[model samples]
Target: MSVQPQSFSSLEQNTESENHSSSSQSWTIEDSEQTYQIQGWGDPYFSINRAGHITVSPQGDRGTSLDLYELVTALRKRNIGLPILIRFPEILADRVERLYACFDRAISRYNYQGSYRGVFPIKCNQHRHLVESLVKCGTPHQLGLEVGSKPELMIALATLNPLQISEKEAQSSLLICNGYKDREYIETALLSRRLGYETILVVEQLEELELIQAISEELAIYPAIGIRAKLGTRGTGRWGSSTGDRAKFGLTIWQILQAVETLKSYNKLDCLQLLHFHIGSQVSSIRVIKEAIREAAQIYVELTNLGANLNYLDVGGGLAVDYDGSKTQKNNASKNYNMQNYANDIVAEVKEACDQAEIKVPTLISESGRAIASHQGVLIFDVLGSNEPPVTPPPVIEEEEHLIIRNLWETYALINEENYQEYYHDAIQFKQEAISLFNFSYLSLKERARAEQLYWACCAKVFEIIKHQETINEELQSIANILTSIYYINLSIFQSAPDHWAIDQLFPIMPIHRLNEPPSKRAILADLTCDSDGKISQFINPKGQKPKDFLELHPLDNNQPYYLGMFLVGAYQEIMGNLHNLFGDTNVVHIRTHGKGYKIEQLVRGDTITEVLAQTQYSSEELLENLRRHTEQALEKNLISLAESRRLLNNYQQGLANYTYLKANDQESCIP
Candidate 1:
């Protein structure tokens, strides 16, 4: 068997009309939550509440649940419309705390002498509320910030003041300056050291090491330095290319030795206090991670043997987020281990390797940005509309029909699991004959239509016999997707989910409300963008199951507005987004959860039409002038009245000032 006994939803629509009503639906919150794999990816922080809404538990599931639907309603009442990015400072702080706690637990468990120093990488979700919260939350834990560019470093530096870090803690905290640094970048980092921030300039190449050494000599500063070794060991999954010999960053083995020799020549080997290597982000397997640690540890020992006074082994961030929520290691979006497992493995590997090499265990630093920031921000957008394929089998024509049409009807009538094999083959042959006869004008239009009706009825019956089978045949499983609904989402795919389009990153998406209602529709979300690629076709299926072609969704009642929330969108999505089709940015709201209720701390409106146009060199003044010229031309031709012309100009100006995205107006209001 390949399909379940349940036929097309339309077949059950009328029969289940009473059960489908809001107050009478029988679906449980737990059952609905399982459909979206809320527990798998959501972990300690997200779950279904009594109200059947997706709720946030910042301190984990045991904490108080904040209903997202309630938040949406509150925000709506406040006049802040959909397609909003919601930032949770509580979740942000909790992530940082949890990440640090894992390492601390591992350290205590292993009796490891060295402490863990977690650094928040500014490149991942570097929004003002998020980075500032990370800095503030990390102060007690002695967490640091890492930057790859000057602007990122500037944000880290400027935010430090507003952050709760004390003067002593700031002086000892690690401010890692990564990437290819120019003279200005190098000097800025060096200047930060003068300001008492413990900044380390991690050399990526021989030339960069030379630059640091030369700069240090001129400035009369014994600058703390680190070397990003190009490792022989490669990472696992999609980001592995960012490591190994093929990687864009870090120093080769020969280059590393040359850099050490150059530093020795400058009598600055003592300045080498950190040994760094990054095997890429979102590492899928702990096995590869342990191997990389073994390799990086050897290099660290060698550097220490060569008399470089290194004290820190900076294991650059790649703590996976389990985006698919499988909690498995098979895919790039998932990792096999939990936070404790990750910390324990890293610590045990470094400890055993260092103990064998007869060297002291160095302080550990992890730049795990994705794990910290991915849960902090969520992109919430609404389903503007939907395009569902016709679900019902067309009514059979009673008048004289083609032979093939009559045969298909007979086959459709006989379709069942007991004789499915025989009826399916007969129906397929009849459908092919009907198509051929119609193409050659041997069959009338009514005959072809009746033949299609019977053909669909046959297919629907075949599907009914297979959907719930233990293992559906690949070919049979694909048939159901043909009838999948195309949900027209309000947000732009390029602007909110660029990774989905660029790298096929899977983010958990589900409706915030109506978890108690059984979803009747299976859909693939299509965005408002004109490009064909602007859609979310692939979705996370159940554990050990293949990815689904369509996401199960509730039927869209035209009177009521439907809202869908895309979860774990905090990292990379914010910065990588583009103005594809000129769908300029969405609204943003900062949410902080408390004992009972959450507060809307801040609200940032998205770009207006004029603002977006200005980015492309079409200023409001220029657009107004162009409109004025057109109106004058029309006036010269006596095409309109002066009053009408004024009204037209006013409307055009208002359009320019309004948000580029469709606004929620009276016509688009949600029905009660």
Candidate 2:
């Protein structure tokens, strides 16, 4: 049966105007014509053009036009294939610099008393290139580092310490230690402080504060202290409860007061210099953030009023970056607030709240890991193939035909009339009856095949008649939706985008090329895995509509490679990816934009069979030896020839040398 055609609106139409100052503007396609203009957060950077092509711009760079077509061309030239993660250091630096600028502008505007310091949390994308870029970009601002684990701490300490970057700017970036602590963790924090780094041990539990105090005293170092308070106002996203009473970390109100009294009693209240609280990550709504910030600011004032030497309000990392351009609620991928608004709201609320409470405005410290790191990386994967609808054979009629077949043929003929509603209903009923009769063994195999063919023909005719109607029935619409094609992708959801499969995190996914042509198919993506659950049924269409489908893609073009980009994956994907099916990490390429164009500075190959086996304590040499011995014995037994045995061994070694997935160049060699 021929597929029915469907038309989709432009993505620009879905963008809502955001509230921005006169100085800040937005980008949009004007008048449904194919023209691109840069706008502020009011207009979505990602939208479908009139041709139904997905267009995207990296956050913050407005005037510079980098559409999907340009991105694909630049990426393909480097020979990076499917499941490749692209790192744009320029975009990362821009985000880091813009954040500091926003805070700097806010500080100057309000004449705020306290200093502002920001850090990139290592928990979000700890890839070497990303972290290096963050450190380099943030060196001007003395950007700090936040660590939650030993590995993350190692990365931060190794990169952010004064020893790494000898410049005066590098010496200024501080290190903030978070998460569960043990003896080694505390020792590392103290050691970092000893290395001339301003290390702040954020106390999640009161017991941790005591442990930290003891460690500081024992080590003979005056380490700074930051207390994470469990605020009453909770955020509204996936990581929303990260700050409230039910949060995994932070102290309760009573506990905070008790800790302050204990510190004062010990004359260590001066060490209690920073107050921290994390409402959540990817906080979509501004109202929730405003409320949470106001609550935290009030606590900061209370601590100050109690004569605690709290100089910094460590607003622990909730500044969100919108992954999906649609500013929807609790999507994890989208946010309702922008950077300027976030900074302004924090500064204004703190100033007002502190003034009301009769306390000094504490210095603002943010641990914005995702916002700093998410935009720096992009996961580019090629579409190896697509699943097309199966072709139906033409119906054959006999002189002595069954009654059901005759009735089906008659119904198919009736469906072609102009006023076809009644005929369509009759056709549908007759088809269902024919199918039931065939299933019940009332019809022969040949008759059943003819009935099925006639049924599909009737249905196809009915769809043709209703295709132009603006308002179709719900049942017909559902059928049409199912008929929408689905494309099978070449990447694993568990490996590349674990958050999407695990936490329902929606990253902005679009075709990396073909932006100039109208996409003919309404498609959902399927991954190459043995599991049936490896398909991506939900997608943000060019019109910004959420379309879920099982079969909505056209046949794959074997001649040319198809690619889909999973954007905003720079945050947690790398660190969170699992070894499901032993399909290790994707090959990572760090792309830096220069005057000449984009350059691939680093290419980290994905984990090979040897590397993956090493993790399980298996030696490749031993495995090869055993396989060779087995094959030799089989050859001696005449199960295989000597030539075949050698060929097999060589093939096995070659397989081990190659990547897990086949590249475009590999298709040229056909093994006889």
Candidate 3:
């Protein structure tokens, strides 16, 4: 499939009023001409379109595009409730295959001698289903696994051991151990090697080298060692400092020299087989990666010349996934670099640097956790009630209020006339006075409300008038752009997209339906959380201005359900979700392409009341007994009837069967 440029329009223009035109623009996805069938699944499935309307065609057969509505109905029929997480196994396989193909294309293009092996860091998702899918899909490439902690190491060891390999593929893939190490961690890595799996303990600090040496001598087995170098080149986004001098992990230049000497002294220099460095997670720019690889390659060449045996260049996890669909540097959460470009640049730069230093190109390895895992999962949420605009009476133009009302009226008239400069200034002054009057109790509440509404209406009108005019002041145009509509969506920001709530990471959010119509409201998404901070103010704007507050949304039905899909959340949402308001995890369903259509292989229900209580160490049995005893006492005292007491106990016990949040429908019968 050929790559096509994606266009982003200003959030201001997506408003409802702006979309009222004869010709409306909508996003369309085309079907892929190529297809392949999986072993069990009959038809081939591929992502044909990623634009406004994301479409998936099974088996590259363009007979008809599979509607997401059909997929949702199939899930609902299978009893998958609201707030569902649909896992497309085909998408997961596609990502793994595409990543390998990209690197292979780059290696061939640059005539690079070194091989490329990718590792799916389990820390990103760590779900058994996802890991299993990765292991199955990645078998052809011998894909590796990266673990940051001890438990993760255990998981990797159990799952990736050579014993698990089929008869045809006897050799095990690589296992890289990252993060801080203690005696237990080092011993675990050694144990993994003892199990016949190739394990590399990446030394993040100089002291770790000593620990590894001590353990190796004690165990009488030399394990492979990887040293993470602190590269000078840093990325320019939230995760940028992950590699520079101030980075948390990796060894400094002085420490690197010391590590080499220590390994040589212990006669373990040959165990030093890999050099690693991480610039950050979600590396946006190709240039930043190119520079960092160049710097690290030179270091690799220098170490090779010093007689250190290093064959693997581990470019630590920074391959970014574009979440917002905006290809820009500021939005690093959405990448400016794609897989092909990223791989090409890495291979080309490393090859050039290694050739200059007269050293053989080392094997290329990436610990890309986000790019491989993010697209496979999606968070589906139901829109509850919205915060409607408070209804107020229209402005009563009395003789005394004539001046203020006319001034407001004149601004709108001028805006409609394309008189931008005077209209903008007057609108600002009128809005301030309108607010001041309300503060001083000079204007009634109704009057103040009318003034505020009129002020915004005039601002919108001014922008619409100036949108087609080229001579308008750019500064005033920028201000008018922000006062547009804000749509309030339902879902907890902290529970759903925490990075957006914490570090302001932007994710691609759009309505599930109504792609054909132009958006009508300038809106900001408001979460259902009770906290005042539960809102999304930042959005994608086409003018390269700061994200605006409001966005346009399609009209919603009061009785029907409305949903918003939070895409690219497969990485960290599950493990990171907190029990704010005691809202537990959402329902998860594994989706895969089947003979006729898509199928839901598994439906893992959300946390039930009993399960959540268990997490807090609450004994449900004890609680049930105590409640029963209390009810019996009430019956003995005649405070409640015997039949009522029995009914109450049964009702309470039955309610605890599922999650606390779910409503109970059936009533318990009394003993009578």
Candidate 4:
């Protein structure tokens, strides 16, 4: 099984003219869509255009569109390199609009009196540009922000407008602080209340409550407070453990009662205006969502009866993005519900629970971070090279050939539909025997190489014979995978998409152009990093199938470049990346379309070699000094001439200023 069936795709090209014409006619945009599952996962934002290039319509089909291939060409013309992260702010705005629209419709259908307020969690994506864009687009709906740390609170305060702080100002944004708070954090949050912000310091622990009370007294500001309840109803999926009794954060029922008593003792019960609970992030089941809401609503009702004036129900971030486009609970990467469904269930469950208790329905607030941020980013990288088997004919059989090589050649020549399996087994045995003979010094290196070539040839022939069979057994499938190509991409899995490597999160990846041609090769992506774990083997399967180990790709043409886009990377990817192997961030570009064209509003350069080195405490000046010293020592010893030493130092200095990624070849600049 250790033998690699490498020559499967490297067999002689099919030269039949009629077959080529038929294949060309059969492959269309629709076929490409099905093959890549773009429509399944990339509904409103991405599609294949008439020119066989992938097009992005940030606000959906009727909105202005741009071809990704053309955009990359423009970037090249501007001297920007490959491995770019593109942000479409229009997509963010559209996601916000849809989120509010769904709740509005639900409110109308239910004839509910309470309104919906949306909040963006800063933890999902801490990038300032993305946070600012979401706040700008969401302010019209009284959209607010939720922060989990001191740094996030500062971001929220700086990004949000504080025109009016009074609760009566219905349009003023709210800031909900929900983490373990220290005295400094509490003081800052409570002080923001005086500066005209509707700031709520959500108490995650009973200890935080006393700290908030002491900080507010010291600052002479009464802070509006929220309590995070530990819900009995747990979520479903990978994040489900974040809920229920043993969750990392949140107060138990006893702690909630104790906090109410302590607030009553301080005559500050009225300051408790919000009740928050989070099921988890990316909740795949709608039923879990509804059940958690019902439980939390019951708590809200009881708290109201207990003299706590609660007016806001904050359902912390669990809105799922349909990453795989399955629209089912088939995997962790997908959700079975849409925005409308989520809004409807939350609204109905909360309304019913409040109605049964004859309590006023509180304003519904959702901290949906993933669904809002996931669709706005696309990561583009190029295929630097590929490792595939040779395409030449098999080695000629000679009378002087080794017996093992002759056996492999005979296995390949004699394989057919009825006996291919038997021949493949025989070939594997022959290969193992050849390796053992070579180890024992019974076979020459030339003879061993010939045996390997013939063994792979047999594998290729067997694959061709069985590929079209009605049933491909497990062994045949394993052989097929061993024969697939390893495409070395100009990307770092740790720096660009840590979730994929860390948690096996799947993202939709496909070529940006050449959709008209059918993909003829199966491949797994290998990043530029030397680490073995830095490879992408899990891929989104077509429609209803399970995830696969290989991605279908077109054979690379030497005359043109191949670019692939990784979709739905807007949430959690940017801020989670690490400098594994010192591979830093990719170049970032913000784009917005106008009518039929697009403009690049901003370009953030990636880290240079000196910058990454400095991040790890390597001083650039010191590095240069050390190199100069080495050059001087060489010169003193007459090991190298003065001119050579100077040239070496100059080259070292230039490399420090260069981008961490591989530079684009000058010849590929004219790829358009």
Candidate 5:
């Protein structure tokens, strides 16, 4: 039987019917939550309310939820520009409390005699406010700080300085110093110990131990020591290589024993108070964590038997945050275990190892910086515009049109359900032929434009047919790519989400409002940076499938603003982001949840044009002077009027002082 051909309009009508039928299902806030997978990664903290706005319950599910849309609206009233970062201090506090509480439960259940102590790794996020807030929140738990560099050590020492004021506070707080230490670094850490902070200088290499011994003797202060053992059990993730014998930091079995013997000879084996091992950050599997802990625990017990005074078992930060919410080991973006499961396993493994060896269960220390900080920060940006294939009826082809263009038009006109595959193939062939013909000067520019338009229209038609189907063949899937729009967002991937661009790290991104409505468009986000790589093509898949290339989004409303939030970026994103295209930072506001509302505690302004230029060695005053000189020359030559020169210079000066990001239109600031 011959398949009947359908007109282009008929194909569109069919697609509209299919879309209306599919989207006609009642979409609620719950449906929105599922579509965005907010519950998967954002459980207990974020949800969509009945009013169609994303709500953040900073204190978790039991606390009052604040509307993110409303919060942005309030900030807009004060004229905050696009691409602002919103931080919830309460979420950080809540994460800390939950982390300690889980370990407490595990310790109680296992009857482990050692107490649990958590230290925030300063390298994870070095924002002063974020570090200070974590310190304050953890003061109750006597939460400590971990530093891996000279700068991070400086911050840790100063941030924890308040603890040194009171002897009780000093004893309660623990400061772990990691990384290869220099003389000044060792002296500073040892001096802090002398001043009564429970500082442990974790020896990363055998050489570091010698420096520690010499520095301590000179400072006349006995330094508390920890050994970072190179574990035999390897990790499993992007950062997994940092573990095992080939690891960059940490000493091997031979080196570790040498350090012990050297410490014994120096009579400083009594200073060996902690054993540390890192199995890499963002651990993907619970089995890996268990294995690493068992190996490290064995080493801890053996060190104790070797007469090294070990009072602390430090599991350096490998705790993972489930950015994709898969909760499976299939990918590196997520973890296969929850925080409680991790705690239980650590406590069980360590206690079993210690009980077998008949040794004391030393204090359990975890540097869980990612889990504590990832969820607390959200980067929000506006959708400036979208670039999509023209849906307007293809321009009427004259009779004299080229044969290649004629073939494309016929394919677009006669595509039907039965022969769309054949027609799609024909269109591709015709488009390629037209491109070759145009390059050979066989086709006019107008003819080429027409051919390109008809090509996209054909793809659009093919996409409409298969979009609602349960499954499409691989060849047919390219139609969806052709139909997807490029949404230009007011965000720089380098300035806000460097990991995504650098390492293919995925963060949960979704519309902040309009949850009651089903999104009708699929788009790949394009950032404002000039670089072609500044775009987010991979998105989190709710079903835990491979990341989707396009994000589902609502049709842009010309009358209102549309915003998207990139969540789980509080860990390394802020500090790791670079000034690509000189985009600088975003306006940051620290929010504290109150009763059914939130208080904006602080607003750190984003970098101005002047500030960013200065970082690149461009003096703003010199820039202005040069521009003024050029403008005066132009006026003297009568190339421009005096009034225009003044106006140009004034605008230039104003632009230098303005925020680095694009300014929001007046229409975008209004609440619908």
Candidate 6:
């Protein structure tokens, strides 16, 4: 028998029915934010404003909200487009001030004698703008720079070289040199002291003592020295493996003793003043920190007993930021303690250890890079579009429909909690038989269509029942996630948020605008890269699955523009990003508030196709030559006339000069 076609009227009616059931109010904006744990994770720095937008509070106050819509409007005029990094220098300043205030509070509450000297690790974020803002804000409170590599040292040295430092200022505002060192690195550290900055060379191994002595003798300059102790107290969190005894860097306890003896032998033990120890980054436990501090503080006392004049206890950078907003240690990304409590725990532990050791309280140094810079950088990107699947009932049920289609439809109509399992099982079994029979041409196309529709309709009803349920079995959970929509985003995940792809790190992702409007779709983000792995499927949720697989995004307005902002991306995201698919960095705009509004202090253009090519040692001239050859072949084959080919080549080359990221081609923006 000939199969009848599904009518358009039936399809339209089914679609409308399906859509009405899953109405927009099914998932409101408030529900979306709550589901994503936005309020929990976005404390102090980010919150939803009355305008239904995520307003940046630069001063850390609830007042003076900077509307992102206005900022985007300003950016359009200035030619600084979206997919930009909106950096608040004032936010950096506030963070620095907050760090100091906490330390100051701890010092005062404990009546501790030593000062808190905070230093920012340059490796976390070495952007010129971030570093400069840090220096400008941190320099006043004697916040210093910690450099692990030669290049980082150079950046620190060059940035600070112009600042005229007096003897008092030099003592207070210090530069710390850490990591594995070569002869050249040691030489550079010693050379930096000539500029009158009290630069400390931290010895990570025992042999580094000889290098420091040799260099000091060669230049007739005595450089300040510190020791990084490999503490027995290891951290617990994402970067915990990088700490402990057998870690990549730091000196063993035996090595630390040997280095101290070597210093004594050279009569330069006073140079061994700063004692540094790092447990790891994003350490969640306060107890781990206290234990580590006790171990290092005792070592500090023992060094003083051995006639080494100890002055500073450098507790290396592990101050965790609340990434998940749970405000508790629910995951590696969430820290249980706040800034003030972190400071108090460290100070009290150190003071008690030193007080019991019968030693003077040494100055405390913390290289809190992540906590300092994480809130300062916000990455903004726009959604190009979305991927939605067909969700409708069958157009018609033919009188002679296949047995499986009739059975499935009957099961769908009979669905209820009491008989859901039975009905769902029957529909699944019948749908499988219908698919197999249709593949072999034993069933008509119209019957096959009806069977498929019947299956989905049953599945949709099952989902609705599952939603009201307090607990769902694993089978139903898989079905729920299977129905998730896909959002196609403009920026490359590798170039923008690498940790999300690499280690499954979840940064706060939400529309910078439209927090007031309810989102209608449960979705995952697909980046611009051809690689399937370049997508963000995991999202933060306190009550749901650990990084519950999908994000809830609003269905596109289709007429107006919309943008999403990724928060706390200041550290490591930019520098660690690879040149995957040759999609370069996004446009960056430094945001600073002026009056009630904001001003773009600087707009740094991202790399072009030609520039990104240069990064991989591919010359632009060579690219043009290859293009020329391809065009010449096309011309000879009569694929294009000489004039059209020339025009095409010129446009291609001009595109090579344009931004590697998406840009507006006309008055209305189109995906590039």
In model 5, the worst 10-residue window by lDDT is 161-170
Prediction 2 global C-alpha lDDT: 0.70
User: Residue-wise lDDT of candidate 5 within 1-672, one digit each (tens)?
Assistant: 222234545666777878766774666778878778898999889988888899999999678789999888788887777688999999999999999989989999989898888999998899999998998888888888999988998898778753532323445468999988899989988888755688999998788888888878887898899999989999987888888778999999999999989998999898999999998899989999999999999999999999989999999888888888778778878888999999999999999999999988899999999999999999999998899867655656767777787778888887878899999999999988888989999988988888988888798877867887888998898888868889999999998999999999999999999888888789999999999999999999865578888998998987898999999999999999999999999889999977867788988888999999999999999999999999999998999999999999999998898888886565344221
Task: Report the C-alpha lDDT of model 1 over 194-234, residue by residue, as the tens digit.
Answer: 77788999988778877887777788777999999889888
Q: Rate the local accuracy (lDDT) of all candidates.
A: 0.82, 0.70, 0.70, 0.87, 0.87, 0.81
Q: What is candidate 6's lDDT per residue for 167-219, written digit by digit as tens?
A: 24645357989989999999988988888777899988788888889989999
Q: Residues 71-177, candidate 3, lDDT per residue (tens digit)?
A: 76456555555567777766777778788889989999999987888888899888888888888877777888999998898888777745435334555578999
By summed lDDT, the worst window of 10 consecutive residues in model 4 runs over: 1-10
Q: What lDDT score is found at residue 160 in candidate 1?
A: 68
Taking the tens digit of each residue's C-alpha lDDT, what string does model 4 give over 1-672?
123333532334444345666888888988889888899889999999989999999997677889999998788788677788999999999999899999999999998889888889999899878888888888777788989999999898899986523333556578989989898889989888876888988999999888888888888898799999999998887889888789989999999999999999989999999999999999988888988988999999999999999999998888998877888887888888899999999899889989998999999999999999999999999898899964345776776677788778778777888998888899899999999999999999999988888787777777777777878898877777877899999899999999999989999999999999888788999998989999999998865357888888898887678999999999999999999999888888999988778888878888888989999999989999999999889888999999998889898998898778885455344221
TM-scores for candidates 1 onward, in order: 0.92, 0.85, 0.81, 0.95, 0.95, 0.92
Candidate 1 Cα outliers beyond 4 Å, as residue runs: 1-26, 61-63, 162-171, 419-450, 635-647, 664-672
- TM-score of candidate 3 to 2 decimals: 0.81
- Of the two candidates 1 and 2, the one with more favorable lDDT, higher being better, is 1
Whole-structure CA lDDT of model 5: 0.87
Candidate achieving higher lDDT, 2 or 5: 5
Tens digits of lDDT, candidate 2, 1-672: 321111111221222112222112332224212221112121433454544344544444353335555565555565554567877776777778788889988888877776688888888878887788788877777888889988888888788745335343345457888899998899888878767888888888888877777887889888788888888887776777686667898899999998998787767898888888888887878898889888888888888888888888888777877654555554555677788988988898898888787777887889888887776667777776555443243355555677777776666655554756676677678767877887899887777777777666666566657767878777776645545555767688888888878877666565655544333455677777777777777654222234334322323567766666777677888888877766777878776655535556887887776777777788888888999999988978999988899999998887665556555543333210
Off by over 4 Å in 6: 1-33, 161-172, 438-450, 543-545, 663-672
Candidate 1 least-lDDT 10 residues = 663-672
